[model samples]
Every structure is written in structure tokens, then in C-alpha cells.
Target: MTAVTKIFHDRLQVILDNHVAEVRLDHAERHNCMDVAMIDALLEAQVWLAERVGVRAVVLLGEGESFCSGLDVAAVVSTPERIAWLLQPDATGMTPAQRLALGWRDVGGPVVAALHGHVFGAGLQMALAADIRIVHPEASLALPEIEWGLVADMGVSVSGAALRQDVIHDMMLTGRHLSGEEAVILGLASRLDEDPREGGRELAQSLALRSPRAVAAARRLRREAPAMSERECLERESGLQRNLIGGPEQREATRARLEGRRPRLA
Candidate 1:
């Protein structure tokens, strides 16, 4: 049976079904723009998902016309308390605003984002945090913070590390928009889909059927490989494989493959 949970007054809705959790950003009237309240909700939602080891996959979506139109600057800057909350740093020197993107990394499962319409500034950064991004061909993505005399500070440096320096420079300097197809070509998005939400959900559902332990290990390896030496990566890969060789999930996977049956992993 599926379970649904709403938190932060439904600004964030989490639907957990068959080990796949769909997190919906529900502030539709403003294209799900990140207001102070919405930011709080997202931060909380990420923290909530981080604690759930059973969640094999996560699909991030936004309600209504757009995935997200980026930050509501007027709303965020007008509130003193919210400003303080956004700026306050944790032990690692990461602010709550920064956490909005990087916190998704704490979730123990692969995250897939379904993006459409305007995915601008912080919205683009948030989508970039996802392991896979499914975007509508017509979706507009931009790094518009430069237009406001601000840098893209919501963990853009960390999340966009793999992007070409020239491509990053062009978007940041020009504050121009890129369509979903162009984004895919530039390596900003995983793929373009006619219905990104459905595509994201289908992908997440398929990932949920895999052995969670193996999936988690692979996810970690993918995240770490870029930073590790080739020798270190090989050693790490071998160590992880050794740990899984005789594990319950591994045995189950082997048994199911041989029997031509779906795996019932723990």
C-alpha cells in the first residue's frame, strides 16, 4: 500500500509508493517560486527524506505550469527573520539557502527531477542537484542571479562542477536562457521528455525495483569517483563489491535473475 505525507502546510507533499517517493513543490500560483515559506518547506522536506533509508528513489516535481521560477527575491529580502534564517550557517559553514540544493545529497537514494516551464536561477541549481533531470523540451533554464548583482550561491559551484567552464561562464555572464534540448546537449539535463513528470516517475519507479544496497553503493561511487584518484577509486569499488558479494540483497538478485523473477530485496 502507498502512503502519503504532507508537511509545512502542504507546500511540500511527499507520496511514498512502492519504495519511490514523489516530492511535489506545490506553490503553483507563483509557478512554485521559492518564497521564504516555500524555502523553509523544501529544507524541511529534504531533511525528512534523508532519514528514510527505505526510500529507494525520489522524484521531485512542481505543481501547475512550471517546475519552479526560482527564488522570490522580493519576498525573501522583505522579511528580516527569513533573511537571518537563510544566512545562518551550520557547523559545515553551509547556510540554509545553500542547503536547499545540497541537502538533497543527504537523501540515501537517487533523486530525479521533472522540470518544465521556467527553471531559472535557484530553480536550475536545485534541479542540477538531482542525480537525473528530466526536462520538457520547451522548459527555459537560466542563471539569472547575475542580473540581480548576485552570484548563483545556492551550491552551484558544487552541483555544477562537471559543466564546462565556458558554458557556465556564458550562462552566468549573459543571464540567458537555455531550452531543455540545449540543456541536454550542454550536459545540464539528463534528457528531454514530452511529459517530464511522468518520465521522472517512471524512471524512479524502475530504480526502486533494484537491490537497494547495490543502488546505494553505486550512487555513492558515482558521487565519489570524480574526486578520487583512479587507484583510490578502483580500491573503493573493489571494497564495496566485496562487502556486497555474499550479502542478502546480492543473493536475492542472483536468485531472481536465474529464476527469471522479480527480485524481492530486503
Candidate 2:
């Protein structure tokens, strides 16, 4: 018999329980910064969750006060050779930066990111990729890459958060931080919660109870629609709806509704 691979037995604190996966950034001393190692670990976490058949929802959180402060500049500056590898064109063709920002979005299930304290630069980009972002009242978000003479190359332009043009422009230009309350009003965050981690768990529990197939379908459409032309978007929507209309999950959902009971979800 083969030994089962542990989902997370390494750097990050990962827990999969009751169909909900909790993926956290645990380096508080460095303000949860994404050093080269952390970036690779995050991508590994994404792959682990994506391959799991039992996971229904994911909760992303930082173990300490902050979500992630940004990239660990010292890591690259101290050893310039590391930067070469990060920027090197790979067989997969995706830069390390892009993988770090968008890997969570590519997962099969919905992701809820709960933010607190300083969520800056790369951190903000990662949060934008989540299916839902719940932020604490005091959490601060900013794109400070420009201040460091670096472009925000981590999927910022392609993510849905870029739709809010005015907000993006101001934050990008001034390196100013947005509070969680303002983030909600501007649509960057889904809502404000006093205790974001607990809020993330509650949301995850609620999502885990929904039809997993429908949840995945909706997430794919939300992502694909934005990258398509109007006609393509409409056609994709119809095609996806056709696939889901009479599926086992849909029938189960209908039966559950008729019986006035919770659906037997994945």
C-alpha cells in the first residue's frame, strides 16, 4: 500500500476539516511577508487543495496580526541570484509572482480571505484573487509597489478588483491605505467583520453546505466572463448553464428544497 501524502506537513499551517480547508500564512515576525520560500509554499498549498476531492471551501488567513505585509525585498536584495530564478522563464511559462497571486483562484473551490492589519502590495493582489474577501475594521490595504519603484506585475490588471478604476488609480498613485470600512463601500471587500478569522470560518461553513458543483460553476463563470468579449461571455454562460441544469447535484438540490431540508452537498 502507498502512504498518503499529507496535505500540509511543511512551512505553512494548513488544516482540512469537515470539507473546509484552512490555509494560513504563519510568519508573523516578518509581518507574514512573501519571501521566495513562502511564495513557493503558497503555490504548493494551492495545488494540494486543488487536487483534493473532499474539500468544499477554503479559508485563507494570516496566523498573526497581519495578513501579509508584502514581498520580502531583503531576500532578493541580499542574494541577487534568487531574483534570477524567480524571474527566469520556466517551462510552465508563468512567473513566480503570477503563480503566487493567482494560484488560489485556479483552485476548484471557493476561497474566502480574511484580512487584518497590514495587507499591502503583493498581499492586496492575493486577496483580490479570493472568491470573497472579509476584512477587519482596522485592516489596511495598499499597493505600495510603486513606492519601491516596482510595477504591480502580480495579476493586478487582470483581476476583477481592477474593475473599480477610480479606487485602483488612487491607491496605486498615492500608496495610500484603505480601511476595511472603505474597502466594503468601494467593493474591494465583501464586508467588514470585527473578527475576520471567525467570520471566515462561518462563511466557509455556509459555503460548504451549498452544492459544490454549482459553487464551482459559478466561480468559473465569474472568472471567464471578465476575460471574454460580450458574445463570448453570453455563449459561455449558456454552455455552463446547460451542463448544470439536469445534473445529479441539481436534482438533489431540488429534492432537498421540496422536502424542506438541507441539500446533501459535496
Candidate 1's C-alpha lDDT?
Answer: 0.89
Any runs in candidate 1 off by more than 4 Å, and if so which?
none
State the weakest 10-residue window (summed lDDT) of model 2. Answer: 1-10
Local distance difference test scores for all models: 0.89, 0.83
- Candidate number achieving the greatest lDDT relative to the actual structure: 1
Model 2 segments beyond 4 Å from truth? 1-10, 89-92, 160-162
Q: In candidate 1, what are the lDDT values of residues 1-266, reduced to their tens digit?
A: 35757667558788877788899999999999998778988988887888766888999999999999999999888988887888799999998888999888887689999999999988899998889999999999999999999889888888888777788889989999999999999989999999999999999998988888898889889888889999999999999999889999899999999999999876
lDDT string for model 2 (46-78, tens) is 888788777888888997889999898877668
